[model samples]
Structure formats: C-alpha cells, structure tokens
Target: MTTELQFFMSESKKKIEAKLPELIDSLLAPESLKKSMIYSLEAGGKRIRPVLLLSVLKGFNQPVEKGLEMACAIEMIHTYSLIHDDLPAMDDDDVRRGKPTNHKVFGEAQAILAGDALLTYSYQLVSTISEEPSKVVSLMTELSRAAGAEGMVGGQVSDMEGENKDLSVEELEQIHHHKTGDLMVVSLVAGAILAGASERDQANLRHFGRELGLLFQIKDDILDIEGDAETIGKPVGSDAGNNKGTYPSILGMDGAKQRLEHHLALALSSLKEVDMDQSLLIELTKYVAYRNH
Candidate 1:
C-alpha cells in the first residue's frame, strides 16, 4: 500500500477504535448486554465500512469528525451482523477475528440480543447527527433500506437457499449484491450525503461503492481458498465446507481472479466519474482488492 493510504487507514482505525467504546458506554442497557455488545465491537477487524465513510468525507474536504458518529453506526451494524451470522442458525462458526464468535463467548440468547441492540443503536447514533436534520433522515432511510430485508437481509436469505445448490454466476452475484454490497454502497452514500456532495457526485460514489463491494466479497472468496487460518482469523475452505456459492466455487480460481479484476476496474472507473481528490479512495480500493484478511 502507498504510504499516504497506510497513514489514512491508520488514522481511520484509530478514530473508530477510540470512539466505539464511548458510544457503547452511552447506551443505557444492562451491564451484561452492554458487555456482550462491546465484546464483538472490540473484537478487532479492518473497520473498512467506517473507514470508507470517513474516506469519502476526506475526499470531499469535509471534517472527518462530522461523520464519525455515522461511521461508528456503520461499524455497529456490521459487528451486529457478524454476531448474528455466527449463531447456530446461520454460518454457525466458532471463530471471528482470531477469537471465539459472539455466540460462543456470550451464549446464543445473549448474542442474539447483542446483535439486536447494536442494530437498533446504530439508528440512534445516526439520529444524533445535528448538523443537517434532513441529511440525517436521508442517511437513516438509506441505512434502513440497505440493511433491511430489501438489501442485506434479502441477500442473506438468497444465500441460505443457494447453499448446496449449483448457482450460476448471475445468481451468486445477486446474492452478494444484496447481502454484502448494499451496506457497503450505503456507507459511501451516507458520507456523500453528509458532506453535501452534488447529486452527480453522490451517484458516482454509489456506483463506485457497488463495484467496490463486489470486489471486497470476491477477494474474501479468494482469501477463503488461499489464506490460512492464522492470517484470516477463520478456517480456510469454510465456504466449500458449507457448500456456499462463491466466485471461486462457481467461476473457478482463475475465473474468480478475473472477476475480481473486473470489479476492481469498474470501481476505479466509477471513482473517475466524480471530480474529487480520489487518491485516498483509489488506494483504499486497491487495499480492499488485495487484502489478505
């Protein structure tokens, strides 16, 4: 990665890490439930969604702090999803970010409640944005649509049904688009909206987000095949073991790599459609496309 990109990512991660605990502490919930929520929140990962939001703000010359609340909100929703995904009814995994999954550490019921809390709390955080009430509402609406049944939840349902079945590339793409791509696209859209970006710029950023989401998932599929348990923080071949439809499964390894490149190119091209300082975003796209974990 470029030194500038690395510096930006480090700053983003630091901001997220510093702010998340305070957000959780402000929630007036039972201590156990709060701990459960914080456990997964603190379980470290790349913090990509929040960083993506802040990156868009930075690209537009907006104050990163102005978007920090919404950024943390995105991370909460993401961590919540991970907790629920690890439950017995979903992926049923026992590891995440090199530690036991939420369900494993907090029990199934508490873990479920933790996910619920975080999901709801995210909306609360968004509502706290006072700079622009209308923009806040727009962010909330976009988040609801993106994270709701019409988006991520819908994609998840499609994924569950596609398991053990031979799914075509189109079908797999559909699943990933909704399940994994919606939130990602919305993260960028939320930042653009908060920054008062032009409609044309917002549209371009949304397109870039969509392609970047696909690129992120495709790289994940590749990592699942080629990465180790130690580096990836989860077992390799879990997708194959679960009979989940993925790019590598449907397109073969080389074909998956080609598809990854295709999305990467589309993502970069979409960035060019908007007139902004895209250097950070361009480098972040490369980071996502090539990350090992």
Candidate 2:
C-alpha cells in the first residue's frame, strides 16, 4: 500500500472510532442494549464503508467532518447486519471479528434488539447531518433503498434460498448486487451527493462503487478459499462448508481471480471517468483488491 493511502486510512479509522462511541453514549436506551450495541461496534473490522465515504468526500474537496455523521451511520448499519448475520437462523456462525458472535455474548434476543437499535439509530444519525433538507432527504432515501428490502435484505433472502443449489453465475451476481453492492454504491454516491457534485460525476462514482462492491465480494470469496483463519478472523472455507454459491465455487479459482482483475479494472476506470482528486480512492481500490483480512 502507498504511504499516503496508509496515512489516510489510519486517520479515517481514528475519526470513526472516536465518533462511534460518542454517538452511542448519546442514546437514551437501556444499559444492556447500549452495552450490546457498543460491544459489536467496538469489535474490530476494517471500517471500509465509512472510510470509503469519507475518502469520497475528501476526493471532492469537501470537509471530511461534514460527512462524519453519515459515515457513522453507515458503520452502524454495517455492524447491525453483522450481528444479525451471525444469528442461529442465518449463517449460524459462532464467531465474528475473531470474537464470540453477538448472540453468544448478549443472548439471541438482546442481540436481535441490538441489531434493531443500530439500524434505527443509523437514521437518527443521518437526520442530524447539517446539510440542506433536500440533500438530507435524498441521502435518507438512498440509504433506505440500499439497506432495505429491495437491497441488502432482499439479496440476503436470495442468498439463503440459493444455498446447496448450483446457482448460475448470473443468479449469484444478482443476489450479490443487492445484498452486498447496493450499500457500497450508496456509500460513494452519498458522499458525491453531499459534496454538491454534478449529476454526471455522481453517476460515475456510483458506477465505480458498483464495480468496487463486486470486486470486494469477489476478493472475499477468494479469501474464503485461501485466507488464513488467524488473519481473516473467521474460519476459511465457510462458504464451501455451507455449500453457498460463491465466485470460487461457480468460477474455478483461476476464473475467480481473473474476474477480480476484471472488476478492479472496471472500478478504476469508472473512477477515472469522474473529474475529481481520486488519488486516495484509487489507492483504496487497490487496497481492497489486495486486502488480506
């Protein structure tokens, strides 16, 4: 990774980690719920979504502080998803971020409520962004669509249904487009929208986000096949164990690696189409492609 990109990522992570706790502390909720929510939020991950959002804002020369609330909102929504995804009814995983799953630590009911609280609290954070009401409304709408039934939830349902089935590549892509790609696209596009970017620029970033999201998932599938449990913070080969359709499963390892390069090129090309200081974004894209964990 470039030194500049490493510095940018570290600065972004510091900002987000500081803001997350402050947001949670402001909530008027039960102590247990608060504890449960904070537990998962504090559990370590790359914080990629929020970092991407902030990086986009910086790319457009916007003040990063202006987008911090939205970035925190994104992280909250992401953490909530992880919490729910680890439940017995879903992937039935017992570990996340190298720790016991949320349900295991907090009990299933509290864990469910914790996810619910985070999801709702994300909107509260969004509502606080000091932008024009129209822009805020637009952001709220984008977030709702991305994280709602037509996006992540819908994709998740499709994923569950496709387990143990020999899903065609197109079908698998359809499932991932909504499940994993939507929020990622919104993360970049939301920053563009907030920066008062031109419609064309916003569209280009959205395209970049879509390609990057696909690339991110493809790398995840690859990691599942070849990543170490210690570095990845979860068991390798979980996808194969569950018989879930993944890039490596459908396209052989070589084919999946080739697809990764394809999406990486597409993502970079899309970023180039937009007229902005995309140095950070470009480096971040490379980091995503090569991230080990």
Candidate 3:
C-alpha cells in the first residue's frame, strides 16, 4: 500500500472501530453470543465498505456523522458475510485479515451464530436511524437483498458449483456480479441516495460501483495466482488450488490486466458525471484498483 492509502485506511479503521462498540451494544442479546459477535466485529479489516459509504457522503457535501450509523451497519453486514464465507462449508479459509478465521477461533457453531446475529443486527441498527425513514427503509431493503439469496449467497453457490468446471466469461461475470458486485453496487447506491443525489446520479454511482467491484475481484484473482503470501496476507493461489473460475483462468494474464485497466478507466469516467466533489472519491477509485492487499 502507498503511504497515502495506508494513511486513509488506518484513519477509516479507527473511526469504524470506535463506532463498533455502540453498534454491538445495541444488538446485545445473549451474553455468550456477544463474545463471538464482538470478536469478529473487532477483528482487523480494511473497512473498505464503510470508507466507500463515507466517501460518498463527503462527495455530496453531507455531514459524515449523519451517515456514520449506516456506514457502520454496512460494515457489520460485510463482516458477517466474511465470517460465513470463511467457514468450512464455504471457502474454508484458515485466515482472514491476517488472523485466524472466526470459525477457527470461536468454533464452528458460535461462528455461524455470530454471522446470523450480525446480519440481523445490521438491519436493526439501520432501522434505528430515527431520521429519514424513507432513506433508511430503502437502504435496508437494498442491503437485505444484496446479502440474501439473490446476491452474495447466490454468487457463492455458483462459485462452489462451478469450482471444478471450466466457466465461460459470461458465467464468471454472473458469479462476480452477484457475489462481489451486488453489495458494492448497492452500497454506493444507498450512500448516494442518502446523500440526496438524484435518481439519475445514483444510477451512475451504481455503474461506477459495478465496474469497481468487478475490478476488485479480478485483482483478487490475480493475487491468488501471483501474489506473495506475506504481501497478500493470505494463502496465495487459493483460487487455482480450489479450481475456482477466475479471469486469469479464462483470459491470459495480459488479457486480464488489460480488462482491469479498461474497467478502471470506465470507473473514473463514470465519476465525472456525478455533480459532486470528486477529490476523495477519485482517490478511492485509484486506491481500489491498485491495492495490493
């Protein structure tokens, strides 16, 4: 990571960590479950989704504090997804964010429960916003759909089913569009809408998010193929080892690189149409495309 990227990432993480306790406090249920919930919530991650949400708020000249709750809520949902995704039933990864996966630390049962709690708690937190009921309802709807069967879950199913098969480009896109792109696209849409952007502007934001999400997964595929374990902070070549469909598997390395570059350009171009300040958001897009971890 570049110094600037590291700086912003660290900054965003601090903010999210500070907000986490309160969010979890609101969801306090059985005391035993709290441990797993807090454990996974506090585990270190890039806070990319929250950062993107806040960036959209800043872009539209909205008070960042106003969106902080929604930002935290989205991060909670994202973390829940990661916890479940890392379970043995899914990707079966042993590590995440450079630490033991949640299931490894908390045991499979608790980890599964933790994901369920966080997913439910996210909607609760979002619904408690008190102001802008319509916006909150709309964002909640988007989030629920994105996290459910039609979005990430669907993408994951496709991924698992096609792991050992040769997947076409269209099929790969479908997998990514649901699994990775859906949350990202909807997150941007929610953020833009909450920030008072017009429908046309929000649609453009969705396009930017869709392209960025695809590019994000492509970079992940590249890392799986060629990234260093220490540098990428996880097991390298997991996709290939698992026989997962990836851009590199279908397209040559050079071709994948070209496609990533093309999407990056398109993302930047899409931002030009939004009638808002673009400094931080522009920087964020660049950071996403070039991120090494």
Candidate 4:
C-alpha cells in the first residue's frame, strides 16, 4: 500500500477502535454484557466499514470528525451482525479474527443479547449525532434498511436457503447484493449525507459501494479455499464443507478471477465519475480487491 493510504487506514482504524469501547462502556447495561460486546468489538480485523465511510468523507474534503460518530455507529451494527453470524445456528464459526467466537466465550444467550444490544444501540448513537434532524433521520432510515429485513438479514436468509443447491451466478449475486452489499451501500451513502455532497455524488458512491461489496464477497469466497487458516483467522474451505454456493463453485476458479477483475474495473469506473480527491478511496478499493485477509 502507498504510505499515504497506510497512514489514512491506520488513523481511521485507530479512531473507530477507540470509539467502539467507549460506546460500549457508555451503555448502562450489565458489566458482563458490556464485556461481551467489547470483546467482539475489539477482536481485530480491518474495520473496513468505518474506514470506508471515513474515506468517502475525506474524498469530499469534509471534516472527518462529522463522519466519525456515524462511522462508529455503522461499525457497531456490523460487529453485532458478525457476533450473531458466528453463532451455532448461523455460520457456526468457532473462530473469528483469531479469537474464539463470541458465543464460545460468552455463551450463546449472552452473545445473542450482546448482538441485539449493539444492533439497537446503533440507532441511539445515530440519534445522538449533532447533525440536523433530517440528516439524522436519513441515516436512521438507511441503517434500518441496510441492517434489517431488506438488507443483511434478508441476504443471510437467502444464503442459508441456497445451501447445497445449484445456484446460478446471477442468483448468487442477488443473494450477496442484499446480504453483504447493502450495509456497505449505506456506508458510502451515509458518508455522502454527512459530507453534504450533491445528489450526483451520492448516486456515484451508492454504485461504487455496491460493486465494491460484491468484490469483497468474491474475494472472501476465493480466500476460503486458498487462504491460510492461521492468516485468515479461521479454518479454510468451510464454505465447501457447508455446501454453500460460491463464486468459484458456480463460475469456476478462473472464471471467478475474471469476474473479480470485472468488478474491480467497474468499481474504479464509478469513482471516475466523482469530482473529488479520490486518492484515498481508490487505494482503499484496490486494497479490498487485493487484501489477503
């Protein structure tokens, strides 16, 4: 990565990481519950959603401060989704970010409650953002749509239902567009909202985020087969073990790689329409395509 990109990522990640625990601590919930939420929040990863939101703000030359709270709120929702996603009933993942899954440490009931807490608390955080009421309402609506039945929850249901079935490429993309792409769409669009960006910019970012989200899931499918378990912080090849449909499974390895290239091109092209300093956003998009874990 370029030094500037590295620096931007580091700074953004640091800010969000600090805010997560602080937000968790601010809750008046039980100590154990707070600990459970903080545990998964602190579990290491790229913090990609918040970082992407911040990058969009930077691209608009807006004060990164305005995006920080919204960025952290979106991340809280993302973390909650991960905690639930790793439960025995979901992906049943035993490991995440090299640590034992939240349920494994907190028991399934507490983990579920922690996830619920984070999901609900996100709105409260967004409500507290000092922006105008209309902007806050817009963000709240976006969060609900992205994280609720219309977005991640819906995608997850499609994913579970499609397991062990012969799914076409378009069907797979449809599943991922809701399951993985929607929240990311909100991230970029929410950044635009905070930056007071124009309608054209918002539309461009919405498209960019969608393409990038699929690019993310496709890389994930590739990594599940080719990535090292230790490096990826989980067992490799679990998708196949679970009989889940994947880009490589449906498209073939070579075809999946070609598809990856196609989306990368489209994602970059979307950014070309944006009139701003996209140096950081462009590098961040490249990192998503090329990251090892």
Candidate 5:
C-alpha cells in the first residue's frame, strides 16, 4: 500500500474501533447470540465497507453523522456474511482476520445464529436512523437486493458450484460482479441517495463504485497468490487450494495487474469529475490494487 492509503486505512480503522462498542451495544441482544455477534464483529477488519460508505457520504457533502447508522449496518451485514462464509460447510476456513473463525470460537450452531442475528438486526438499525423515511426504505431495498438471491448470495452459490468446473472469464466475472461488486455499488449509491445527490452524480458514483469493486476483488485474488499469511491474515493460497476461479487464473499475473491498473484509472477518473474532497477515496482506489494485505 502507498503511504497515503496506509494513512487512510489506519485513520479509518481507528474510527471504526472507537465506535465498535456503541455499535455492538446498539445491536445487542440478551442472549449468547449477542456475545457471539460482538465477538466476530469486533475480531478486527479494515472496516472498508463502512469507510467507503462514509466516504461517499462526505463526497456528497452530507454530514458524516447522518450516514453513521448506514455505515454500521452495512458493516454488520458484511461481518455476518464473512462469519457464515468461513463455516466448515462453506469455505471451511479455520482462521479469519488473523483470528479463529466465529464457528471455531463460538461453535458452529451459535455462530450460525450470531450471523443470523446480525443480518436481521441490520434492517432494524437502519430503520431507527433519522434519515428520510423514503430514503431509509430505499436504502433497505437496495441493501436487500445486494445481499439477497440476486447478489451476494447468488454469487456464493455460483462460486461453490464453480469450484470443480472450468469457469470461463465471463462466468467468473459474473460471480465477482455480484459477490464483491454489488454491495460496493450499494454503498456509494445509498450514500449518494441519502445525501440528496443529483441523479447525474449518483450515476457517476455508481460507475466509480463498480470499477473500484472489481479492482478490489482482483487485488484480493493477487494477494491470495503473492501475499504473506501474516499480512493477509489468512492462508495465502486458499484460492488455489479451494480451486476458486480468480482473475489471475484466467488473466495471468501480468494481465491481472494490467487490468487492475486500468480499473483504478477509470475509478479515479469517475471520482475526479465530482466536486468533492476525494483524497481518501482516491488513496483507497489505488490501495485496493496495491495493498499487500
């Protein structure tokens, strides 16, 4: 990662950490489910999704506080998905973000329940936020579409089924477009919509988000091949080990790097058109392709 991107990630990490407790308490339950949920959510991550959402909010000239709940809700959903994705029946990962998988720590049953609770509670958290009711409703709809059968979940299904098959580039693109790109698109668009952004700006931001999302996933694939386990906080070759289709698998390392650069350029160009302080987003876009972890 570039020094600038490292600074952005470090600053964003501190912000997420500061709010972690309140976010957990806000979504808390009386049962052990709460404990499990907090355990996994607090396990540590880049908090990239929430930071992205908040960046868009800032870009659109909205008060960052106004998007706080939305940011937290998206993070909750993302964390929940990660927990479930690491289960023995799914990716079967034993460690995540440099710690034991939720199922490994909480047991498979409670881990499942914790993920369920976080997913369900996300909607509740968004609903209670003080945004326009119509906007909130629209945000809820967008999030549902991103996380449901047509998006992340569908991508997961395709990924699982594609493991043993020789997936073409088009097929692999379809999966990443949904699995990784969809929620990212939602993050920018939702922030724009909530900030009362012009329709034209929203379209531009969505384009930026799509390119950014694809770049992010391609970098992840590269990291799987070349990153350190300690730096990436997971098994470095898990993608190959699991027979997962990836950009490098189809494009080769040089080709994948070229594609990442291309996407980053397009993403930066899109953001350049907007009248906003894009320092963080620009750094993040570059970092997505350059990060070691």
Candidate 6:
C-alpha cells in the first residue's frame, strides 16, 4: 500500500476507535454486557468497513467527521458479525484479530448478547441521525436490508448449507454478493446519500463495491492457504480443514489470483464513474485488494 493511504487508514482507525467506546458506554446496559461489547471493539482490525463509509465522504470533499456517527454504526455492525461468526456453532474460531475470540473470553451466552446489543445499538445510532427524516429513513432502510436476512444473514445461511458440498463459482459469488458485498455497497451509497450525490453516482459506487467485495473474499480465500497464521490472526488452511468452498479450492491458486486481478481492474473502472476526487477511493480499493490480513 502507498504511504499516503497507510497514513489515511491509520488516522481513520484512530477516529473510529475513539468513538466506539463512547457509543457503548453511553448505553444503560449491564456491566458484563458492556465489557463484552467493548472487548471485541478494542480487538484490532483495519476498520475497513467504517473507513470505507467515511472515505466515500472524503471522496466527495466533505468533512469526514460529518459521517463519524454513521461510520461507528457501520463498525458496530461489522464487529457484531464477527462476534457471532466466531461462535462454536459458526466458524468456531478460537482467535480473532490475534486475540481470544469473544466467546472464548466472555463465554458463549455473553458473547451472543454482546453481538445482539451491538447490532441493536447500531440501528439506534443511525435512526437518531439528525438529518432530514427522509435521509434518516433511507439510511435505516438500507442498513436493515443489508444486514438482515435478505443480505448478510441469508448469505450466511447459504454458506453454512454449502459446506463440504461442491458449489459452482456462480453459487459462491451469489453467497458473497449478499454476504459481504451488499454491506459494502450500502456503505458507499450511504456516503453518496449524505454527500447529496446524484442517483447515478451512487449506482456507480454500488458496482465498484460489488467487485471490491469479491476481490476481498477471493484474496481471503487465497490467504487461507498461504497467509501467515500470526499475520492473519488465525490458523492457515482452516477453510480446507472445514471443507468450506473457497475460491482457491474451486478455481486453484493461480486461477484465484487471476480472478482477484480481474476484479481489481473492474473495481477501478467502475469507480471512475463517481464524480469526485477519487484518488483516496482508488487507493482504498487497492488497500482492500492487497491487504495482508
């Protein structure tokens, strides 16, 4: 990644990290529940989802802080997903972001509650946005659709059912489009909405986000085979051990790499349609496409 992008991401993370604790602390939840929620939030990540949301605002030459509340909301949703995804019934991961999983540290029940709390609070935060009622409604509507059964939840169900079964590339793509891509697309669209961009501009961002999300998943699949356990914060080859259908498993390593490159090009192409200073967004795409973790 470029030094400038690295600096931008680091600053972005600092902003989100500072705001997350404030959000959780302002709630009137039980102490244990608050601890569990904050514990997972403090676990290290690149803050990509939230950063992506803010980056879209930056791309429009708007103040990044204008979207900080919404960015934190996005991060909460992403973090909640991780907490649940690491449960014994799901991916069963022992570690995340190089620390013990929330379930491992807080026990299964509290971890589940923490995830539920975060998910619920995220919507509350967005719903309270001081924008016009229409924009607030638009944000809430898009967020629900992206995070609910029609999006990530449905894709996760499909993922669980597809385990150990041979799935076509189209099937895998379908799973990820809703699973990972939709949330990302909505992040960009949310920014466009906040920035008062044209509908066409938002559509362009949606197309870019789809390809970018695919690129991210394909790279993740490839990394599951070749990434360092310490760097990626998990055991290598876990997907293969679990018999999950991954891009490398289906397409072979070289083919998966080729596909990653293909989407990178397409993402850049689609991003060109956004009417803004897109250098930051372009760098952001490369950041996702080429991340080590």
Could you tell me every candidate's TM-score relative to the true structure? 0.97, 0.97, 0.94, 0.97, 0.93, 0.97
Candidate 4, run of 10 with poorest lDDT? 230-239
Kindly report which residue pairs in candidate 4 clash with one another: none
Off by over 4 Å in 2: none
lDDT of 5 by residue, 191-259 (tens): 887888877877888889888888999899999889998888777788887777788998899988998
Question: Whole-model lDDT, candidate 1?
Answer: 0.91
Candidates in order: C-alpha RMSD to true structure? 1.1, 1.0, 1.8, 1.1, 1.9, 1.2
Q: In angstroms, what RMSD does candidate 6 have relative to the true structure?
A: 1.2
Clashes of 1: 0
Query: Tens-digit lDDT track for model 6 on 239-270?
Result: 88887789998999999999999999999999
lDDT tens digits, residue span 191-218, model 4: 9899888889889988999999999999
Candidates' C-alpha lDDT: 0.91, 0.90, 0.83, 0.90, 0.82, 0.89
Q: Mind giving the per-residue lDDT tens digits that candidate 1 earns over 119-149?
A: 9999999998887688888999999999989
What are the runs in model 3 whose C-alpha is more than 4 Å off? 1-8
- Residue 183, model 5: lDDT of 85
lDDT of 3 at 258: 88
Off by over 4 Å in 1: none
lDDT by residue (tens digit), candidate 3, 136-181: 8888888888878999888888888888899997899889988889
Clashes of each: 0, 0, 0, 0, 0, 0
